[model samples]
Target: MENERNEDPTDWDQIGFIISSKYRTAVLEQLVDGPSIPSSIASRTSLPITHVSRALRSLRERSLVELLVSKEKRKGRIYGVTEEGKRLWERIEAEGMVD
Candidate 1:
């Protein structure tokens, strides 16, 4: 979906800042079910591995979610949603229902 439109810079920025792209939203949804590896996220979301990785990087930069841990020799890195991420998920779901 396209980003919500708003003339007020702050209002637009508030939502747009969280989900700047569809891939980012997909990444968030994957985490909502539970923590999983990036590969798992890609499989579940049907997003390209490269896109998922990029989205995860952006999410991490914003502190919306975090890599909980890496297991078994730096493989199977589990990611979890932070408090802010949850709130954003709620907003996205709510808006989706309206749409």
Candidate 2:
């Protein structure tokens, strides 16, 4: 489904579908607060490390989030919303789409 194209690329309704998984949404929420690594996200959200890793992978596949840096001794990554992600997030918030 990643290859599906929308007439409007900025459509949150469509982007949301990709990121609508409960865990994925939670991951986005964690990133919303600030840039964080997977371990921090798991700790803060009370999610398993493996689940967070899987969610992050899915999010990256959809271009909703990005890996910032992984250097030195830090094996984790910092994730943040992309421009496309921000636009979709704004639209979702404006539409009161959150449960």
Candidate 3:
């Protein structure tokens, strides 16, 4: 079901899917300022760490976010919006999709 949705590749559908989740939208909003690890995003968004992690995974699957750094260890993984993500985010903001 999720794989089917990911295969669509339509910008509107992608944007709609992203904005549909508050957690995902919050994470993207936070990333707009700069790259951040999950903890930082969780703190800023006031969402739990686990929720943040899940949101990151979903965003990554959609190619709207990328992991900037990943060590052999579990910590210090950084994430930022991709170029396509930046453009879509701008549209999301410009069109006032978020409250």
Candidate 4:
């Protein structure tokens, strides 16, 4: 998660990327089941709202996850894993990396 944008986008390991942050991993895992509001994800993952927001922003940046609500909405904005996120998550889960 440290200056990873500089790496070749194709060369970057998506699985490794999510695995590097518990926040990111937890958010992804929660979304894997289905899209949910940030509050639900934070509550289920036992992570702070701040952390979840950061993770969401990062994942969205890579097109791994997406906002399911209007961008103008300040609250109740749901988030869901993208197909790309599902693929990376499946690879991570297959390796028993999910908590």
Candidate 5:
């Protein structure tokens, strides 16, 4: 879906910062196709759950990622990239920001 928010040039800096971490980049890569839980992401990326959790938090704070379920639930809090996130992901891919 198209992002409702206008693209901000400064968002490049935030995107750059987020993808700078290998774990966060891996997390984003996994989410590109669809939403997933932290455990799934960690397993797929072969990263620790704690690390993935941290990455998700950072992504959420940037509005690049969002939780699909209640925080209190905890067991299956699905995370997906926002429309703005998709736009940023495309830019990052076009620029070859990460492999």
Candidate 6:
């Protein structure tokens, strides 16, 4: 659903969906800075690899993040934020949702 209209970061539903989960917020926050592998994300976010992987999966399903490498390669798969993700992040920042 990458083409879906999530242009409004001010959308309360979308904002609530994101801030409701710390893992999702942290994962998205990390990716917004740049692309990185899951392990690196886990390390930087200080979260477990399992949590990072789950967050990535959820974010991918929402079109907020995407797989940047060959999915079949398995290990060291890279992920980056979508334009929509950046928009959401901007709103989250503006609202001071996270520390």
My TM-score estimates for the predictions, one after another, are 0.76, 0.75, 0.86, 0.85, 0.87, 0.86
Candidate 3 collision pairs: none
Ranking by lDDT: 3, 4, 6, 5, 1, 2
The lDDT of model 5 is 0.87
What TM-score, to 2 decimals, does candidate 5 have? Answer: 0.87
lDDT of each: 0.77, 0.76, 0.89, 0.89, 0.87, 0.88
Superposed Cα deviation of residue 30, candidate 4 (Å):
0.2
Model 1 clash pairs are: none
Q: What is the lDDT of candidate 4?
A: 0.89
Q: Tens digit of lDDT per residue, candidate 3, span 1-99?
A: 775576546878879988999999999989888999999999988999999999999999989999997645479999999988888899888879999
Tens digit of lDDT per residue, candidate 2, span 14-99? 55674567778778777867788999999998999898889888878878788888544358668887776666766666667766
Q: State, as a TM-score between 0 and 1, how close model 4 is to the true structure.
A: 0.85
Worst ten in a row by lDDT for model 3: 1-10
Q: After superposition, how far is residue 96 of candidate 6 from its true place, in Å?
A: 1.5
Stretches of candidate 4 exceeding 4 Å from the true structure = 1-12
Which candidate number has the best TM-score?
5
What tens digits encode model 1's per-residue C-alpha lDDT throughout 1-99? Answer: 244443445533535865668888888888878887899999887889999989888888887779897535477778898887877688768767212
Error of 5 at 42 (Å): 0.6
Q: Which tens-of-lDDT digit does each residue in 1-99 have in candidate 4?
A: 676666556534787788899999999999999999999998998999999999999999989999999999998999999998998888777768876
Clashing pairs in 6: none
Candidate 6 global lDDT? 0.88
In angstroms, give how far residue 98 of model 2 lies from its true place. Answer: 1.7
Q: Candidate 1 — worst ten consecutive residues by lDDT sum?
A: 1-10
How many residue pairs collide in each prediction? 0, 0, 0, 0, 0, 0
Q: Estimate, for each residue in 10-85, the C-alpha lDDT of model 5 and write its tens digit.
A: 7878777767899888888888889999999999889999999999999899888999988788688999999978
- Model 1 misplaced stretches (Cα beyond 4 Å): 1-14, 70-73, 97-99
